[model samples]
Target chain A: MTTNGGADLTRLIEPDRVHRSVYTDDAIFAREMEAIFQRAWVYVGHESQVKQPGDYCTALLGQQPLIMVRHSDGAVYVLYNRCAHRGALLCAKSRGNTGGAFGCSYHSWQYRTDGTLESIPLPAGYEGTRFSPGAADYNLKRAARVESYRGFVFASLSPSGPALAEFLGEARIALDNMCDRAPAGEVEIVPTCFRFIQHSNWKIFMENQLDALHPYVTHESTGRAAAELERQMMARKQKPPLEYHYLSAFTTPFNEWDKLQTVNYPYGHCMLQGYMGLRPRDPDTLAYEAVMREHYGAERTERILGVNIHHVLIYPGLSVQPALQQLRAARPLAPNRTLTEIWHFRLKGAPEAIYRRALAYYNLINSPSTMVNADDLENFWRCHQGLAADGGDWVSFHRNAGQDDEHDGVIASRRGTSEAPMRNQFRAWKQYLSSSEH
Target chain B: MPVVIKKRSRKKAITPKKNSFAQFRVSDDDVILREVEQFLYRQAELLDAKRWSDYIELFDADGIYWMPASLEQITGDGMPSIFYEDRNLMTMRMKRIAHPHAWSQTPAWGTSHIVSNVTLEKVDSRTGDVSVRSRFHMMEFRRDASRHFAGVYHHELRKTKHGYTIRLQRTDMVNGEAPFDYVLLAWV
Candidate 1:
């Protein structure tokens, strides 16, 4: 129950509650960066972000800076964004093409797209010394393991662990469903993303993703306003656009939310069943369905569209809404601060209207300017402030604790409002924090 | 309350449509410039006072409010932007923020906008359609935090029967890419 540092891991995380220090303590946060983030298969940039050879984008794995680049040989590599010579950042911008090689701004040390040292200035000065350009230390350090599943790239800092597929487990369906939704069986990332810094711990954001109970309460105002407008429009014999329902869906009563379900998987991954009837009989949707049916037969297209998933939480980091074609990656900055990048995708070969639907959801619900996100962010900040204070010591996850159905390490919540996802996440958290392996 | 009916038209509403204006030299540049400045300052005043309905009324029926995520973003369609909304969406936002249970507005924030650098980019001397450019620094204080948003505002004003109404208001923020502490609850 105790970690090597003598911190009581079991005390920090219980079956139905977690200690406040888990969300506030500096030592615990640092330990999480090492025990979980560094060891887990953390999500990097999608392969679509760097479509062409020599194209590169920077990402953060835990606190480590990394570069996901496409090499001339058409291979993608996730390398540490550091100059091996003087420890300066190799890629200064978020994304750009490095041409043939990355020339460090500080010392002009050149590195191939694959992270191997290509050349260095003043080779003669290092001939008599211990410096060797050909050594592995001089090359940009690559992540211990890098893997892509359907173009979604992930990297692990540890040299040994489960492969990316195993780490994903049943959660891989989230990615599969997204890719399957595309007519070409692929998805491309939208280049720009909204980066938001929440004044709360990373787990707070992750837990809220599949909470299921908070949407109606936290976003009641936004929902009510949309619902009211929808009512007025209906009274006028007018049909409101589907985008209004994106916000009004938050007005879904608590009982209806409970009728939905969440499935928890190992490695802290969890998924919430679809609640927004995304498949409407609108002309745009019908046209999109026709295009999908053209590529995939009726049965297959129906199967693809019928996948009832709303949100999937790949714990400690990513939250994906597969049907909506959007995902958010959380990067912990400090115990009290976390940075989240919100990225959405275009289902390849699908009608542009479908992509616009995803874009509508992205802007209406996920954008920083949205009332939905604003209220959620307020709750996150308030939660952190309350947790850090002396007012409370334990955060409860006691909603329907003993009622969950577990089969072979997979948990299915009896009610969608159940806090089983948090309990399941802490179960993985405890395992990662207590293990001496990394 | 005057209700703005939501149009069900499938037309791309937020797209920056080119207005057909007769290009001609303005005879009274000073008069037009002062009028444009006053209109902009009034818009800012409405925003600062949290006059949501009045602020919404400043826009024409088919007007758009856009805040691009970057300076290079020219088109709002198909690209991710901070905000790209038509009158309907803006009205929806206005109603939502005014809802009593809008938790994010709990300790209701206050915003002060300083409008400067008012320059007339173009003028349609016949119809009075004009393009105006100005810089704005908006300071928003909510709870214990104060944030500053400085941006350039490009307003395409359509001359209406009453006065000029905004056909498009595009904000290019200097800190559009910066890491914000929390959500932006209101327009800046």
Candidate 2:
């Protein structure tokens, strides 16, 4: 239950409670960055993000900076964003096309889009020296492995884990549903994003995504206001706009949320089912359904639309709401600080109205300026600040502990409000950290 | 906050109605311009003074309050916007913030919206509608943290016997592209 320095990592997590130090200790955060984030199948970027041959975007795996580039042969590459000459970072911007090769601004060392060394400033100066342009060390170092599933690319720092598809397992449905919504069977990344920094540990953000119990309490004010307006509209014999229900849905009673379920799998992949009633029988939706039925058969389209998933957590970093066409990635900067990038996508061949629906949800729920997000961010900061003090020793996960069902390594929570996702996460955390070869 | 003044890109043609307000002199009289400026200052005062009801009365029945996610964003119809509220939604926002259990506003936000650079942009003689552009710097403080938001405001005002009612109010923040510290839950 403890680490080498006498800090008990095992004691930090119990069946129903976790020690406060798991979230606040600097040593634990460092170990998590090295063992879990760096070694897991961490999502890098989408292939659509770099469609053009020379297009590139920057990402982070744990604390290490990485660049996801599209090579001339139309393959996506994940490489360390560093110069071979020194440790200076290459590609200072967040995203841009590098043309044919990346020329490091410091010392002018150049490399191809696939991280292969291209040229050096002076070949004669290194003639008698040990420096060789063709040396493997001179090329940009890539992550140990890189792979893609349905255009969502991921990379692992350590080479000894399961393949990306095997790692995703049941969670792969999240990405499939997102792409299947498009008639063309693809989706494109919207270039602009909302990047936000929450003053809390990254785990807080991840846990909140599937913690169905908190919305009713945390967003009560916003939900209540929307509910009031909805009532007024109903009284006036007018159907309230769908946007109002988006906020009012947070006021869903505990009994309703309890009827839902959380499916947990090995490697910490999990999903919370049907929190949002995305299948509204509206005119815009009807038109989009017709198109989907045309492209995919009626039966197939119905099955795809009936997946009933609300949110999927891809283990450590990514949280995807496939139905909403939005995905969020969390990157931990410190034990007390985390950065989240919220990106929304458009179904490639869906109607413009459907895209607009997703866009509205993006602005209303996911944007940093929304009441929904503001409420959650405040709690994250407050939780971190509270845990840092001596007031509380343990964070509880006792809601529906002994009630969960396990079969063939997959765990299913008996109730939606169960803290099974958090329990599953920590169980994976222990496995990743304890293993000598992650 | 650092001021970022990016050079306007040449890809999209600039709309003259949004840019040439100061270039052409409309109606040799300055009375309407002064009234527009006064109305704007009073709106800012009402918001800072927490007169939520009085502030809501300043808008027309069909007015919209919009803040686009980016300065380059031209339309709010299909694009992601930070704040896009009709009268009903705006009323809901007011009600939510005033609620006792609004946790984000536990220690209520103290905001000072400094309004300046009021300029008359356009006048629609047919509909008695006028457009004005101004700049704002809002300082918000809450729960031991303080932040400032600087932005340009574009207002479309409809004249009535009672005064001018807002048809549309759009805020384009200067630093809209950067990552925020937490959340922006107020009028930007």
Candidate 3:
């Protein structure tokens, strides 16, 4: 679309570069909402969000507000929130038990949990009219497809998407790694979430999710302070407290981040290997591992436990960390305004202390209250604001580009600290953007 | 922290006695009820005026400040939570705000606590610990804007050698999961 004549679509988004307007322009963002967000398989909600027969929660896919609800027959449905009678928006609350039917407060038009029109407030109103109940337009519209992968829900507004699993490809590992880590091969949603608005383009945050390089730089001061305290405690020759690692991990030298490899898969999905060294020999962790071993056999259990992914990105939307049970979805509002949902999870049938460990990471690092998250938000806002001014044209991504390694369509970094992740993402972007219209 | 109550005029006829929580032999006395009410009211006064450090000292070392993940997390065996903090964690949270990197704190939220319905729930005989419950309607203000938050506090207190020290403080925030207007850089 950016090209005029019979030029290459892929050239604009080559591995080494991307158009500046992807961040600084408004029109490109709208096209993205239509072509990418509306068409791609976007995550809807976790099964735990709507466990009961009639539980429902509101979610956003791009600019469209969609609701994910559980029907009476136990199937999940994704439906548009607009009411038929007077265009009243349904499901006013963020989340609640819909009680088997959705009733519009404006006209009181009732709909079944599955999104069919159950009844109108008055029967005689449409008696000799075109407003028939059986009409497809009269019923609440459902998304084109709703699919679940290991209890994680996804919806595609378009009728065609390669199916959720095929689209996921090897990125399926993200969810599999998440669920399989649980002793029972399942993880429950942390019902509540911490939602915050960032005054930046969504792409910046997505790129930063698995940057695999900025943590040691952006978080150096805070991490160094905490690491020093930990060093002092260690000098006394006693085991340092757990909180010390929280700060000291940021003190990882620049070269160490390079050692942590990043893998960018097709469809914009990518992964950053974990370096938190969270596998501690504490009693609580040992008890958790014992429960894990009890549920899964030794080899399979070892495989699941061996996975060390820090972040797994599912393309232009969600960033998932399976090990820590962290899921964050970015919804682009305006050219500059983006909203993110911060969700943590609990592995079912696991010890309470295990959940507490996840909670500590959530609160201390990811929570809005935490210093780590606060630092990220400030940079996000500042970057967006600075890009808005008439000072610059391009935001560079040419860091160690020529040195990337690729084989059989699977791109890997040469050095662990290479910029191959961004290049790989742009590779997928060009593929999507350059394809002939379906 | 900002408490939103004005000083009350001395009453001509305060209620004689009401057995809300502990039925101490002294609980039946009118003087004890009045004294207990005054204690809670004074604490509220200190909290409403941004005296956060002073309010935190009212808790014991082993105190817990909890805001449950969901209404069903009574036994702490469900999803992660709004907050499940011990005293040390709470102290660390406060310390982060004093730093320069907390963007939300750059222009910090100015919060006012509208506490009401103070009622003593029960009393223990062995250690003289008292349990109290209260409701709060808090209005968090930032950038000339305000958002309303309401919650109930379940306070478990112990009578120390000097004064009351809180063992547990659970604030059940209904709006905890709602997209926050700004990050809570300090205690509310």
Q: Highest DockQ: which candidate?
A: 2
- The residue-by-residue lDDT of candidate 2 on A163-267, one tens digit each, is 998999999999999999888898888877898999999999988989989988999999999999899889989788886778999889888988899999889
**Candidate fnat values, all:** 0.83, 0.85, 0.31
Interface RMSD, model 3, angstroms: 3.2
C-alpha lDDT score of every prediction, in listed order? 0.89, 0.87, 0.75
lDDT of 1 by residue, A167-186 (tens): 99999988999999999999
Q: Give me the runs in candidate 1 sitting further than 4 Å from their true place.
A: A1-6, B1-27
Question: What local lDDT score does residue A362 receive in model 2, on the 0 to 100 scale?
Answer: 90
Compute the interface RMSD for each candidate structure: 1.1, 1.0, 3.2
The better candidate by TM-score, 1 or 3, is: 1
**B149, model 3: CA deviation in Å?**
5.7
Clashing pairs in 2: A1-A10, A2-A8
TM-score of each: 0.94, 0.93, 0.83
In model 3, which regions exceed 4 Å deviation?
A: A1-20, A124-128, A221-247, A434-438, B1-58, B69-79, B98-155, B172-174
**Cand. 3 Cα-lDDT:** 0.75
User: In terms of TM-score, how similar is model 3 to the real structure?
Assistant: 0.83
Clashing residue pairs in candidate 3 (N, C-alpha, C atoms within 3 angstroms): A258-A416, A258-A417, B2-B48, B3-B48, B21-B121
Chain B global fold similarity (TM-score) for predicted model 3 against the true chain B: 0.74
